[model samples]
Target: MRTPLTAGALLALALAAQPALAKGPATSPNEAATARHYASLIAGSQPNMAELTLFFTQMPKGGDLHHHYSGAIYVEQYVDFVDRQGYCVNKQTYRIETDKALVAAERAKPAAERNCLSSAEIYADDHTWRELLQRWSNKDFFNHGALQPPPDRLFFQTFGYFGPVSNSNFKEGLQELKKRAIAENVSYIETMFKLSPAVANPDFDAKAWQNANDDAAFDAQMRAWFAVLDKDPAFNKTIADFVARIVDSSEGIDDERFTMRYQTYVLRLLNPSLVFSSMVSGFKAAKSSDKIVGVNIVGQESTNISMRDYALHMKMFRFLKSVYPDVKVALHAGELAMGDVPPEGLKFHIDQALTVAGANRIGHGLDLAHETNATGIMQTMREKDIPVEINLTSNAFINGVEGSHHPINLYRKYGVPYVISTDDAGVTRHTLSNEYVLFASRYKPSYAEMKKTSYNSIRYAFLPVAEKQRLTRQLDQRFADFEAKIARLAKTAAKAP
Candidate 1:
């Protein structure tokens, strides 16, 4: 008969099982002192926040792993796309319209004889330009309080305004994003963009698409569905074109100081059959080409349809994971907050996303505190090493979660893995560097925590084995270089004339 373990022993075992903090063994005393000295220099600089901003802007961020590719381009740059595509923008509503026939007809007329105003024409109207800017981004807005629609509504609506603009300028969007990432000293990005639409959905057994009777039944149902999809040449071409577009988008993008990969997503707010079918298509695309790294399910999680079908989507991911065991899934789970969603609505989203959906990483995870068995869910995440992609500005803009209510501190306490990201930098009018600055100023995390989180972003990225190793080494070198520069600056400033 074995003796039961003591409380201390059990506690130690449990602690050992949880994921470790990104912080490794402590640095030498001099290195620690130098870090503290640099922190003081940053904190004590003239016009301190500006200096702090500069510090973070120049800091070597590992990567932005939760970026939305379309949402990463600035609104002004998006306007440039509108010009290139010859799209029209409504002056009153600021909605961009792309009627090829209308454009052709207008071009056929004399320039002064045109009926509709093209986006270039709108840009020339200084009075109306700000309206399009505000419509497309969080510019001139402070918080949810200042937004016209509910913040969530406003945030999601920006995507619709630029949908037509985005399709025509994927390459431009990437080049701009890459330039911004390089400016911020970031090295890698896993940006989400929608893949081309899948072929027509097969005749749906709506019930069959909903919750599978059981795991085995789910497998049978999905196989039947795929059996139908597998026959369509249209579907095959669509998948190939989707994969080709991703590579095509990277044509002029420079990756010398930057590495980027695509995460194609299914908009989860659609019909259940469409959502699952898109996921199948997304997985196929990502698997067919290395250009696309993985697949995700996007769209607001708190709405009636999504909330209702949340578990079913997880089941869909679960079933798909069985088929493409190697295909990575980093889902947008637990993005809901208290007021945005009902209390019960928050309880099981992150839980199901982790357990049932087979999400390798969770995006946002704002509702971690409200999940049913929140503690247990965290423990499972810790044990499984599932990192949360924390999007600071996006959460602040959409969910009004920040300061003490934000979950990163709890994530720290529990040793749950997490990495900072820019969810929709263009829409939020922010960047990965802005996230670092906000976290540093708001949370007052130490330099070590900063380094750890930066490293963790690359460590937890969905890149392939060789790429992860290469980026990790690059990040390590970058960190060392940054630390030396900061320390030298601090020391030199102390002895200045």
Candidate 2:
């Protein structure tokens, strides 16, 4: 009886009104109180410590996407594992050493004294032992007494110092990290550890392409690397062995449902040609293996080589897209500052990472505010739906940025998607809970907003769509159960008065 326009308008009106009428209590009173308390905490009002602590503890963090496996294991734990294996620590450098020198040292010690100190005791010594932890990872920044190295040096040195032991037992290494994630109520870990073969070989030059120009030569070199990962049975056998080791070592542990994804990371500080080759190599590996999910450009973006190679890396990604169209990228961009590097760099990392490299996700986008034509980048990021991984403590500790200075709130304000991550929690002696607490206490996120952040991790993740949906449903049910428990506890506490 009615015209089509009239009927459509009427349906729209009804649909708009349905939610308000059907879902009565869209915002809970308790949620409002918690939001108010968060505001007070951010505004310098010391809210009840117990409630604040409870809020963070029960907050369900979705997943950690930016974790590094080696840096994720506590330094003390790594020391314990090695010492238990009867390894000797270098007294002068404090490096866990091997080869004849270390073996002789171990043999020289008295039988009763050798490997006798507990990890807890070793870590307690501030003068010699704790200093080793500081130097081997990112902990140097936290110690007021130690002479801290520059952020770039400290971060990269950690890898070289612990490289030997880390590679020795990747399977046991993963189990340790998985158990830590489960204890923290985290379900998935997409870590940046172990390199794809190209990044591993000693002959792979760090400075070979300082001036390389011939595209043909570069392609030839890439084909050789690809041959190793694709054609060589030995290389394939190594990957198979690593996977079996992880599965075998992780048997019989029922913590949180844990999963691992490889991020074939390239050192950005290499020559432009080599960096480009590594990018292509990483992408090829991702396409060729299920275990490898994505490619990452790691190392210090502040270095001259890295800065110079930035644009080329993006261009390389664009070229590789034709060869491996399905491979994903999650790059470390905008990890620099105006004070940290030249003006040219401060302006472009985010844009290049998103538009050129086709990054599905971005890591440590700390310099978002400083990028030039940033409005366009923000608009593009929002339109494209790329999520930036935010690491609160890592930013505060390594980059020396925090609170109001961090770009996280800006992303929230602009409606840009994001996920919270612990870039190197083990090094900082923090956990997912600590980062969530920092968000609640510092940024004043509502419980609903915090829950939204949790979901963002899985949603923004590179997991298969079906797997993502399954995990999302599981996470939602878990959160509902968590909220019900908190509600009952709140009622009991209120009734006590």
Kindly report which residue pairs in candidate 1 clash with one another. Answer: none
Q: What are the per-residue Cα lDDT tens digits for candidate 2 across 96-175?
A: 65665556666677855554233444565556576776777666575567577777677767867666566666666777
Alpha-carbon RMSD of each model:
4.0, 7.4
Tens-digit lDDT string for candidate 1 (342-403): 67888888888888888899998899888766776667777788999998889888999998
Cα lDDT computed for each candidate against the true fold: 0.78, 0.69
